[model samples]
Target: MTLPTTAAAPPSAPPRTFSAVLVANRGEIACRVIRTLKEMGIRSVAVYSDADKDAKHVALADTAVAIGGTAPAESYLKIDAIIDACRRSGAEAVHPGYGFLSENVEFAKALDAAGITFIGPGIGAIEVMGDKIRSKNHVMAYDVPCVPGIAKPGLTDQDLIEAASDVGFPLLIKPSAGGGGKGMHVVEQAEDLASTLLTARRVAASAFGDDTLFLERLIRAPRHIEVQVLADNHGNVIHLGERECSLQRRHQKVIEEAPSALFESLADGAAHRERIGEAACNAARSVNYSGAGTVEFLVSDEHPDEFFFMEMNTRLQVEHPVTELVTGIDLVEWQVRIAAGEVLTVAQSDVVLQGHAVEARVYAEVPERNFMPSMGRIVALAEHGAADATVSGQQPDHANVRIDSAMRDTLQITGDYDPMLAKVIAWGEGRTAALDTLDAALGRYTLLGVDTNVEYLRLLINDSDVRAGHLDTGLIERKLPSMEFRHAGPRELIAAALTLWLERPGSAFAGDAWKVPDAWRVGARGAWTATFGLPGAGTATVSVTEKDGSVTAAVDGGGPVNVRVADRSGTGLVLEFDGGLVTYAVGSAPGAVREISVGNDGWSCRLEVLDRAERLRRMLSGIQREEGAADPEVRSPMPGTVVSVSVSDGDSVEEGQVLLAVEAMKMEHQLVASVAGTVHLTSKPGDLVKADQILATIHVHVATEETANTGQNTDKEVHP
Candidate 1:
């Protein structure tokens, strides 16, 4: 999907440029724009919330301004605050990087009214293409192929129901002004349509500040393809090929690739690419669009040749890096020039898709726990780059790998906005090679504090269906159930405990304990016992002894194994155990915070080390409590606002029944009943609960007279 090259005359004037530009966003995107601004010799201004006071983006900018609170509505979404910041910073232009106010029409108009340039499409284009309903209607007039649905002007609820009836069952309801899968629902049956519509509207209003929705026929198993369009005020527009964004989870894109694999399957691949490119250009021309934008399409899986108009994003997309990699074009630079009234420099024929490129979003979320978002300090960060690249902040020049991140060691990831921490892009001569590089990059990248989906992305890229390019929007959801969490094994545990033994301030021996490494102990030795707890994996007693010039170790009832300590460095130990050499990098905090990583395999765990006697006492006390079990209380898994309470006090519910829903990081999670019993609700709707706070108590029923009288059983609560 290369652009055609043609002979052209030189421009009569120099390209327009700005003095300073303010980035009205946060996180990786803000860092990305700032890098480009620095390359262009323009001053970069950054705005941050309370949570991002010490963020990487803030440090990268030439000047920083604190807007408001941690939440988006109080900060990034406040147009007045952003405008004032721009004025205070003396920035002549503003770049809304992808999210926040990037596609807000009012924001654009306000910037224009204040005599500051907006480095994106014009307000008219944002107003028309930003709304899905209007965008479809506007495109249809130009004879663009669009999905059949209802978008009548001034349509009422009855009109929507009538349209829904005509569209048949399995219709999709989406926010007219939404992107990123927020407030989108597929109603499989008529009975649930009304309820789903209500939820969709509420979510849309909350996320996008718009409750306007449109109904469309649900295209089952569809492939999502979007073409990047760059237009100039001089009426010149061109497309930078397409991005395949079919791999998704919960309707949001997780992995993306450029020069879509689907194009290679077409008989006339070049012609097919040209057709889509022209349509995308036309979409921009229809709205007199200027600067950077994206036109999205839904291609039917059964009919790859057929594509329908979905909507247009009037701002740079989150997946822009993929497009930039293949084209070797600086889209942000072009955006700034376009807004400065510069004419298009790259012609449609000059665009070329060099090599295959792929991008996988690294999010601070745990895939095993229903992809729940995580927040905490990033205790350790490692990005393996080329031999010549620096491990610190220096950008990697490896042709195969590129990390677009806003993360640094000791940085905190707060639950204020999107959970994505970074985007890892890999390029190669072909698709397979690119995917291989991506897989390797994910393996070498190490992130400690917060949970990430690096392993899940690795599994997905290697999946047979994914490798064969059999992609669809439902792939992640279909594959999620089969993905297993890799737990730390016994060998890893031993290394962890051994690391604690060596690194915990003083010698392995405590007060009154025999100093084993004494002058008399050179030839004689005895077993030393230490207790280690692997959080959810229970506790174990590790026995170590040096016998006959060889160290022997045992855990629980396991057989003794010969162990050799080769060397010791700062927080790193080289051990020869189980007939193999292993390296463990350990991070120790006072008390029981011992984090250990097993070699370069990216397998790590946080284990607690305690004295054997204390562990024994706790273990015995736990057994005593189980013998006299009580009703289990259900607790909140994380700090969040309770969005819905579905059950009432004294209500009898079955196992897996929904008790309430909690909203954290814009994602809603339902708390379910652990066992079939009478539920005593403790928290009500709209309550802000902390992690592990009691939400409800379930009293199980038993047949035994003693148990019935005590009203208790040995049922343990399952934490998700």
Candidate 2:
């Protein structure tokens, strides 16, 4: 079923609808806002950085202005440039869609000074509620219960350590600014408190521009629930129910839904919903807030009735679609209407919750590898569902299924912004139906050429605890160890090899098998061995032979299995492997000429078809390197800038000591020592390194069992 996103009705006097409006954002949210603007008959102006000239949002808007820079600070965050664009375009209002300047008080003030309407809460409200420390202190007077913590301005590493006991053990260190769990860390024990604070403060300063942090008691088995509140300039405030956001990893929400399943299990669920909704409204009223905002709360799974105020998000949340789908209210249209000075026509009694809706955030990440951010070109794109993706605009290529995305063919995914590509939201008559719809949609969400978390998301949503709504903040971490993620097996490997070999110019697909390159020949039985470089330092060798018009393939010299390719298109291929028909999404990117990507059943893998000479060289080199010897080299796992280096050159460290951190795509990965030895560093802070680039080498001593046991250790036995 489609989510009805009709524009709001015309409002009364003292204000007028603007003919044009500017959206100061990028990516899917920008595209989402422009859709609503079109429905309202308002001209939408899009501002883009240099990197986004070909982005979906820019093409969707009626007019586009290039603020012109790839980095956020150079373009989207430039307040003066955005104001100038608005003035030049004759736009009377601007929608600060979430991230960039949505909660920025100075940006709102600048708009007001320029005589432009800001489609959000007032500057005072943004200022008070933007900072987590201030918002927590401000809402307590209104009787909103807050978690016990040492929350105040200017708490340093020492301040937190000294007050650690007062706050209690197992406390959380959180940055007062920014959302999305960017600079948050949990200190489980007293011994790890100081070092975590140092890293937390550095990350906070780098991310939020303010290192101001506070501490909170880590709620055990806690569920994260947030209530959506909408307030107008005319003192009209209402709550749009609540969203269950407990399914998260590292405090980053992975899945969210409306009408908490935990609440539905309660005896008097309606009363509890009303109480929580009223509490959210009370928090909004205290700040004199206006426009769409979310009040987040932490509730324990054991005691579903008891709740505590966590922090109020002063702007629209990434999970707002679920609220819109369940309530049948277009929040963006209302935001524009409110900014145009409208009064609330629908009362609290008129606000009714409908069917359940669930949303899954699809990110460009490798979940199997600790959720590493993936960046590349969109080589192939296809989506399947009953309905077309909600659109009023020119996001030319996206499949059906209530998808809010800026994804398209050939669009480049870079590290300049967040790795979140799109959101897949589904609705049904009941919670079970909604969850089932969501899972099916995720399975149908196909994308290739870049690694994604889609497969892991399916595994997660189908988990026994998740399906049963045994939810908590730590549930994802707890379930991750037991979750089995699918990998590219024999079918995928053979498919990749055959597709690459068959697609050449003098190719096997051309009817003359002898004309094909590699090991093709016109003999009674044609046989060839192909080597492929798989993901994560893996390699697969497949031997193929053609006889009697049927192909049999053996992987790494295993038993032969039947394989057949029935179809091949620009985007995918239909193959019958081991007597089972499967449609595989296939693609290749310019950056990788020898590489090809293949996908099936919500999982995808990229493998390189190595030449015969290259494969032989690698095999010889691999043999030369001892298999069980301690590798002295520490390579960067990903391409990113070195944010922090913990150890100095020539410093002796233990095997597990933290050496440095690499930051890419808004996520940070800490690299640790591989073995106990003296580190010979090659990289330092602020160095931009590439994937598998050696950052350091640990000089270690290694000896054979015979030499070590005989106490004949010599300098020759030491290895570096």
Question: Best lDDT goes to which candidate?
Answer: 2
Tens-digit lDDT string for candidate 1 (52-126): 899989999999999999889999999999999999999999999987899899999999999999999888899
Per-residue alpha-carbon lDDT of model 2 for 1-720, expressed as tens digits? Answer: 111221335455665788999999999899899988998899999999999999989999999999968989999999999999998888999999988898889999999999999999988889989999999999999989999998889777888899999999899999999687778899999999988998888998999898999999989999999999988776767888899999998889999998999888888888888888888988999988888999999987888778999989888899998888788788898889878888766567667888788889999998888898887788888765422244221123322247888898888887779899989888877888888878887887888888999999889888888889899989888888877877779888888777765665554464654455556545564567778887886679988876777788889999998888888777778888767898888887755336778897788877777777778877885786678755678998777899999999989899889999999888989989878877889999999898789999988756667777788855232554
lDDT of each: 0.79, 0.84
What clash pairs does model 2 have? none
Output candidate 2 Cα RMSD: 3.9
TM-score of each: 0.88, 0.94
Mark the regions of model 1 whose C-alpha exceeds 4 Å error after superposition: 1-13, 152-162, 386-397, 506-537, 540-552, 565-574, 588-631, 701-720
Error of 2 at 145 (Å): 0.7
Worst 10 residues of 1 by lDDT: 386-395
Q: Which ten residues in a row have the lowest lDDT in candidate 2?
A: 391-400
